[model samples]
Target: MDAFYASVELLRYPELRGQPVVIGGGRNATPDTLADGTRRFKRLRDYAGRGVVTTSTYEARALGVFSAMGMMKAAQLAPDAILLPTDFDSYRHYSRLFKEAVATFTTQIENRGIDEIYIDLSDLPGDPAETAARIKQAVRDATALSCSISVAPNKLLAKIGSELDKPDGLTILTAADVPPRIWPLPVRKVNGIGPKATEKLAAIGIETVGDLARADLELLQANFGRTYSAWLVEVAQGVDERPVVVSSEPKSMSRETTFERDLHPRQDRGELSAAFTDLCTRVADDLRRKGYEGRTVGIKLRYNDFSTVTRDLTVPLPTADAAEIRRAATECLKRVPLDRRLRLLGVRVTALLPAGSYIAEPQSVQGELPFAPD
Candidate 1:
């Protein structure tokens, strides 16, 4: 899916096509419809908040705006860009449609995130390019959105190759293409390499995949340790043996939000209390929808200074009821200090058990909440 969130919004407001648009505003960003049958959208400069970019159109990307970047910063870069609120419900709907469409070709797909998947096409009998094109068309037909795809010999190459072209793209890679195609790219282009690793690699003059490939094994070992160094070397050589997992159980479910303004614990208790309640309710809804209950409930808090804290409590039994989850999370909350203003809040449920595995019984009453709702 290419610029998935923004593309979905484009379907609703085709007038905004070809323009730099951003998605991440609160519900207040919803466009107003005028009597003239025209839509009035908010602009990036009009945005004043702490949320990060969820996704942006390629036009906005060209202006240095991208996902997870500060909304204020994005405003400075693309102030005239159209701003829209986040719509996860619609995004998830199209996600299902696209995945179902692809299932018609092959079922050996590893679910990645809302917009990406790792597909095993080795058993499919077809030209790789043609097959990739068909998949792209299927996605567009099913969701009215374009998606870029790649058919590579391995996941590592496939991941990198998919983005080589933009909008709607189809790329094919073979083992013979690694040196001429992949080696010249920066080490940071490799998926698993992070900022820290990239910085260390730069210090040693190993800036590209080709450089890493020809680096001394002893030098790599001295810098990154034997296990990681060996792994890095193999990665440089385009070696990835991990199989595509068809399915797996989730370890936990959580919901969090960064605030538009730093919220004081004591001064903004009303707002923090509402946000905390909303997070708990949302997490509970997610658990019930997925047919799972959890024994552990937790809360995460990030201070205005960017420091963080988290605490969890194990209940007597797994449960997905909103009130139960909220109460347990409140217990976890009291164990931490709220002396500083908060920038973010989150609630999580873990130690999951399938809801159908056991009968949900009543929970024992606990003491009154030690603090206010937040």
Candidate 2:
């Protein structure tokens, strides 16, 4: 699933092949039909909104446009790039097609979101590389799309190997290749090493996987917690014991939106309130559709400057009522400092339980609420 969203768009507009394209615009960004019946797509230069890049083609990436980048900043880098609104339904359709195609080879597969997965091929007979090639061909046969595949002894190395090459890449690795292939890479390339941890590692002169592997255990534990430090050491040596999760349950459900224009909390209180309620309703609808009820309601706010904050409140009973979710989310919002104009708002439900297991009660009980930065 290389440049997944953009590649899917390319399938729809073949004429735009090899050209810079971005996906993130709203409905109005849809291409228009010309007098000659040819389609005219929107250009990034004309985009003026708070929308962020959902994905960009490799051509656009070369021009410095990337996923999660503000559309305005991306426009500054590749103003002439074609802009297209996201079509998630089509993406999901392709996702299902590819997964089913892969299932033809093995059912011991772990779905890692819509674009990626981990397959347990150890039990399967034949050369691992050949098997991966067959799987990749199956996906292309099913969806006419290309995907990168990595075959390694464990999940960690496999995940990193999959990213070593570009579109339609196939990489194979073994424990013997760890020192030569994985050691020199940046520490940030490790799965669990995030930005904050990477910065801390850099400050301590541990910038590469090799450095981390050689770092003192006590030093790493003092910087990171004991558990994370030990895990880091194990991963640097290409030792990941976690098995592929064959199935998973949803931890939370959420709905969020970025406004076309930033809205001041106080000045646009009425409008904001309506949007907030609508978000809660959507979250509740999602919970019901998924047959789950959540006890924790949370609100997320991203200001004009792109800083985000989240707050959550737990209730005594699990519920999927829109009004109840709205009430809890509203309470969570009160704990946040809304001094700046907000560009995005979101509502989330967590601590989920099966909808059939919990029955709504008339009694109201409040639980502990906490504010956290997201």
TM-score for model 1?
0.95
Give RMSD to native, each candidate: 2.2, 4.4
Q: What does candidate 2's lDDT look like per residue over 3-96, in tens digits?
A: 8889899999999999999999999989999999899999999999878999999999999999999999999999999999999779988989
* Worst ten in a row by lDDT for model 2: 365-374
Could you give candidate 1's per-residue lDDT for residues 85-197 as a string of tens digits? 99998998999999999999999999998899999988999887888889898999999999999889889999988888877988888888889999999999999999899
Show the lowest summed lDDT stretch of 10 residues, model 1: 365-374
Candidate 1: stretches off by over 4 Å: 358-374
The per-residue C-alpha lDDT of model 1 at residue 228 equals: 96
Question: Each model's C-alpha lDDT?
Answer: 0.91, 0.92
Per-residue lDDT, model 1, residue 167, is 75
